[model samples]
Structure formats: structure tokens, C-alpha cells
Target: MSDAREPVTGIEVPINLKYEFTAGAALARFLSSIREGRIVGQRCPGCSSVYVPPRGSCSRCGIATEEEVEVSDRGVIESFTIVHIPLPGNPVKPPFIAANILLDGTDMACLHLVSEVPTERVVVGMRVQAVWKPREEWGYTFENIAWFKPVEGA
Candidate 1:
């Protein structure tokens, strides 16, 4: 005997709460740098680990990071995945690549979208660089750098 499946349905719930999020000291500076088409990382004097998107303190040594270090825009893709699923409010369309990149001179990796290359061509160790939006479009946010793309001649 064969079994039949039942149809499932649910009501659409919409959330409309108004709220504001403030990025504290370290993060605020990091975002500001991004807006200016530059990337800055904070160095942990104790352990010397550099964090992109600058955390106020070091995760390993538990000491506050104070030195602002400029990091290279180009980096190697440590890991990545080609996404095929679609979701509401996704910044990019489906079938895009999301990557974890280790910016040059930094100790940690930052997650961001990778584009300008076919999904099949993306791989771990692929060199990529930030593709920033027009200067007028920048703000104190991650949106400043539109996305990352493969570095030419690399």
C-alpha cells in the first residue's frame, strides 16, 4: 500500500519593531575605516593576534587591544561555500558564494560575499580583494564594501 502526504500551511507573521543598534568604540572605528575604503584591525599587545572588524579585546589573552593596524584589502579565501538556496532579505541573489577570508597581516578571518567569479571557480586559497561601492554610497557600515572579487593577476 502507498501512503499519501498531507498539505501543510501557516499564517505569515510580520515583525515591525523599530530599534537602533550602536556599535561601541572599537567597532565604530572599524566601520569608519571601511567607509573610507580601508580596513583596520586591532592588535592584541599581549598575544599579538589581529582581529578584523576589530574586537575591543583579545580572545586568547583576555587583554584589551588598542593599536589600530591597517590591513591589506587582498587576502586568501580560507574557506567558502556556494549557496543555492534562496531566502527572504538576502543581500545577493541565489547561487552566490559566501567566503571566509584572512586579510593580509591579520590573524583572524572575516565572512563576506564573494562574487565577480563563477561559483564553480571559487576555492579555498583563492586570492580575492574588496570591491567597494562608490565613495558617495559609503557609510559607517559593512555595506561600504559591496563585496569581494577575485584579484586580477593573482
Candidate 2:
């Protein structure tokens, strides 16, 4: 046997996943509102807490959320992170800000990308507004809002 060992080589196996998602009634309403450039949430009758991208029920009170509430597109950043690592299939490059935004009138924060401002400038309580894609490209998806950005004069 030779003292030298053979070098190991590896091959990349690409995997693709495709599936159809059936949205419940509450989620369907949320998605539909998103397509129309409106952000809607469901209010829990018990606690009156509003949930964006409403999950059909209130986590706190354990009751169905049926009242649709329109929330402001502008919000405050509750927390955020500056991403430096690349994520596969993500079109946005590194050095992006991912933030949990507390939209006006909503009790829960939603995660979204913050752009059009310096990463270092992003901070908790920073005011931001949705930067929506053109109306022509509207679809039944959250992608309708391309990203959020710091609101001027806010």
C-alpha cells in the first residue's frame, strides 16, 4: 500500500422543494390586503391585541381573531441585526438590516428587511415605512412590500 492517500472529491447535489400552501381564512384575508397595498391585522376580541399577518387566533387570550384592523405602513424598529452572511436564494446582498418592526396600532412586531439607510444608522425605535413594489407587480405575497426604509422627517 502506498503511503500517500488519494484526495477526496465532492460533488454538489442541488435540491429544490416545491409545494402548494393553502392559507386559512384569516391568513387569506391578510394576503389579499397585502396585494392591495394595505396592511391588515386581526384583533382578538378578548384582549383587543392586534396581530399582523394574523394567525387566526390570539396567542395571549386563546381566542379567534376575526376583526380586521388596518395598521399603518410606517412603524418603529423594535430590534434589528446587520446581516453579513449570504443566504442561498436571497436576492439581497450581505450587509443588510433585518429588523423586527412594531407597526403603529399593532401589538406584535413583524420581521422585515430595512433598507435605503446606512446599516449603522439602524436602531431601536427608528421610524421606518414600507417601500412597496410598483403596483403592476402586486401579487398575493408579502413580497409586495419590497422592504422597509427609514421614514424621512420621522
Each prediction's TM-score versus the true structure: 0.88, 0.90
RMSD of 2: 2.5
Q: Give all candidates' CA lDDT scores.
A: 0.90, 0.93
**lDDT at 33 for candidate 1?**
90
Tell me the lDDT of model 2 at 140: 93
Candidate topping TM-score: 2
Best by lDDT: 2
Candidate 2 regions off by >4 Å? 1-18
Residue-pair clashes per prediction, in order, are 0, 0
Residues 16-133, model 1: lDDT tens digits: 8887988879999998898788899899999889999898999999889999999998899999988899877885888988899999999989998899998888989999999989
Q: What TM-score, to 2 decimals, does candidate 2 have?
A: 0.90
Scored against the true structure, residue 75 in model 2 reaches a CA lDDT of 92
